[model samples]
Target: MAKLSLCGGRAAVTAGSRLLASGLGAVAGGERYTNNFFLYDCSSAEKKLPDHKDEDGLAMAVGSDTILAHAFSSSGSFFALTDDNKRLILFRTVPSWQCLSVRSVARRCTALVITTAEDRIFVADKSGDVYSFSVTDPQGEARLELGHLSMLLHLAVSPDDQYIITADRDEKVRVSLLAAPHNIVSFCLGHTEFVSQLLVLPWAPDLLVSSSGDQTIKLWEYVTGREVQSCDLSTSHRQDGDEDKQRFAVSRIAASCSGSHIAVLFDCVPTVHVFQFDAASRQLLPGQEISLEHGVWDVAFDASSGLWILQEDKDEVVLIYRLADGKWQRSLNEESMERLSNHLRDNWTLMEGCSDTESPFRNLYKASYDNMAHYLQKKEERILEQKQKKRKGAQQETTQQTKVLHPVTPSS
Candidate 1:
């Protein structure tokens, strides 16, 4: 069998397979088991054409605060998700959609990635220890691999399989030999804040790309741990001095398969910064900036197809985007560059201002607050408000949903 999953689980962590393999019905049978692993026959599930009008992409219904992180194997066949419950659920692609394993760790699982060669996985916890689990027997005891001083933000394995690169909350990226993780390779230094994501360029295996809460996207050599280039993106997305009050940090960053484009996402901002990757100069040049209706929670690129997926805040579905003319834009094609620009003028209505009466207050991006579902939910409440407006005295009971405690991270 061609294993679609890379062995170790880390950022660039493969969580899904683009190939929905055919001829799935031949082995379609009742429930089966292999060494306690449940087999899934995807063909057996009642299938119907998905409605286009419905929300698109692989939508995780987990509340915004509940989902910590999601990863796909380097091969994209296997998918894994770590939730607030500290449970890691692994899913298989070929032959069927089945839950291969569910491992409950002692502490919160922070980051994970599949290895390039073997089919095993590595998981990092908030407590700073790394553990390896074999996909074949994931529930079997996990072997402790390594540990970090601070909370690990992200990790990635080198393409040559010679080393493992890990980034922590305290602005450090450690390089260690894969075979002997305790043996240090070198440290890729100089990130002032927490590193959010790491990418080993596919086209140039020697180059590594990283984004950080320090408001920078940096490139470096993972072998010698030498800085190649760095770009401060604080002013790249926002222009005027008006943005001084609100702090902007890098939430996520992703690179394309060919390493031609890079995606940058920030906290509380609805814009996606597109940077053109200069493989020759080992630099990133500004390209396009695509603004969404809401801030992005996470971003992923499909290496096989060259498409992008964005998880937006307060949205039930993951939005699918595409690269057009060297820039990342909405895949739906309904929102053009003109439309995106129009949003700045028409959609953003300044409602809140500072007491100084002269200082420019933050722009309340209306799209973030104008949620369609929220509006419908408030329709009945609006009717009640009108009724209460007329009635002498009417009791109003507010229904509250328990707020899920979001994971605390250096970057987050």
Candidate 2:
């Protein structure tokens, strides 16, 4: 393997007969890699979910079909996919590929989330309704609804699945207790414009992050919903004047599972900005910024693989970047890419086929509440039984040791 260090990271290239046979084993050990000079056909990468459509003659547009939002469940077995239409779709990975679940939300689902316990999927809709669906049930169940005065733009579920924090078009952020049914714990109010995104740090229950159209990202204490740190994207660019201000729109945001790093995708800039936050000082320091050709629509970090998935809007390409070396690669084949593009076009037409009075129902599924609760209860019981068995084995060993040795017992 030939290893080279460049631009704040190191890159290792595998040299082997296999590499020669494949031209480049871009896919290796579950991580994909590509250099700055190379571009691969990423059209074949599996479509995780079907296209979401709207009936109002405003079916979710194409170039905008770029996953505007995404969320990984606590178990990571499932993920929620939301497109620019803000419609929500649930995807579960089968042995071969990811498949859609029965539960789907109709409103423009801007954000998707799963409770930490993996029992429920929390969907924040543009219509201001936060819908909760039970994941365990075959029939999607709707639990409680949190109605916002304005459009519910974003949502983040805590690792414990006890709390759900939401951002709305009203520029207000609210935290509600998921377990307690309809309890509004607190509200974070400060942003002057629509709150675009919300991210909860994996390890920190108290730390919640929000990005707003006000051109800033704010970090808050989950318990209090109090703003602890704030950073202005407007200051990121050195250029002055209204042009710079107009250029800055914080589109998508993500926090590394470790809580050490944050990635912010801006609409105006072609580069993704990384920031490191100091918990002690509550300050955000600029980290490395990686530039790409197309504007970034969404960014997701796979902590297990240490890979970053960046979806670009213009070319409709999903770029995979290795965190260790900053090597960028594209997934999917040219044929698959064309298929996806065509699929999007076909989906638009299908969406257009729906009349204004008709509801859009192509990719959406709904599951029921009682079935979800029963499934979770059964799952917990099984886990507890396994734990009890392990404990019994340990006790048996201790009891045998405590038994007294009686050499003469046979004689008696």
Candidate 3:
């Protein structure tokens, strides 16, 4: 297997493969060049935004029906994507992404991680259960491991395989012994809301970084339950004005493989903020912000060369950007994503339609407040019409009474 050198600080490199934007494996290990290709606007932030082919200037689109979760192995030899329908597809990433096996879980899988040893794969689901399976297991039998009380939002294993770190929606980061997951080491509790993403730096095993719905990111040493640092970045707000700005939360975060750069992003947002990570001091410095062409769902970047960005509006789920002159720039052309590809779940249809009684949204009210306002508006209009009618009728009656009282006996 050929390895891509991700270390020159910021040097020009070459591309071994045209990045396939739909898969996560390519950017995880693919060789990219910093040749300053004219295809994409390099450092578009430094100047005015330029008009590109696609709206928001995105290169390509991956039009999968629905993709729930995706991840690449530690060695970058394998990649997997979990469909919204609970089917998990594994791919061999070395020569090319070849479909290895497919397994369907009972619930929607939220996160996946391959062990540092690269022998096992673990997947966490929204139902709070974590399952482990062999990497090469064609059967794809997911064995049950420890479980959480709330929905498992993220998963991470220590470099030495001593502890398994799991973040839950209940704002708790639990550290459990992998060998006996039932024996939890400690709970890193600081976030006020749901925990969304988790990362333990490869070079610094004791340090852990986590992002959460409380619109903040925190660094912790899980074994000792110590909070090292925290940053408030929850700026993305709901445009509808129905929800609070902090509700957007810090959902997705990626650190460069070299561990020098950390990127943070949010769901339904087109902007990304990069932070410089000082490995020695274990502190994160705010860096430049990159605006994308469309709303993005997730983002991942290599420490040295490339970033895998997933967009929501475009058909291409994954977009590649290469590091150039200390700044990450979009390099891979849009044509690379033009060719339509079939994923493992390409033939599967999103299961839809349900009886009113069985619908999960059955109890959901359609903003009865808004409806009540409309109702009151109509009621006021009706009342005004009735008042006008009564006034007209009273006028006619008064005129008739006057005539009767007058006893008009003349010309009329």
Q: Which prediction has the highest lDDT against the true structure?
A: 3
Regions of model 2 farther than 4 Å from truth: 1-70, 82-89, 98-100, 104-106, 237-244, 304-412
Residue-pair clashes per candidate, as listed?
Answer: 20, 22, 7
lDDT of 3 by residue, 24-83 (tens): 222323453222111111111112222223457774332232445666666656666565
RMSD of 1: 21.2
lDDT score of residue 218 within candidate 1: 84
1 against 2, candidate with superior TM-score: 1
For residues 271-377, write the lDDT of model 1, one tens digit per residue.
77777777567777888777666534445454332334333322222355676675555555322212322322232221111012221112211124757888888
What's the candidate order when arranged by decreasing lDDT?
3, 1, 2
Q: What TM-score, over all chains together, does every model reach?
A: 0.62, 0.59, 0.62
Q: Once all C-alphas are superposed, what RMSD does model 3 give against the true structure?
A: 14.0
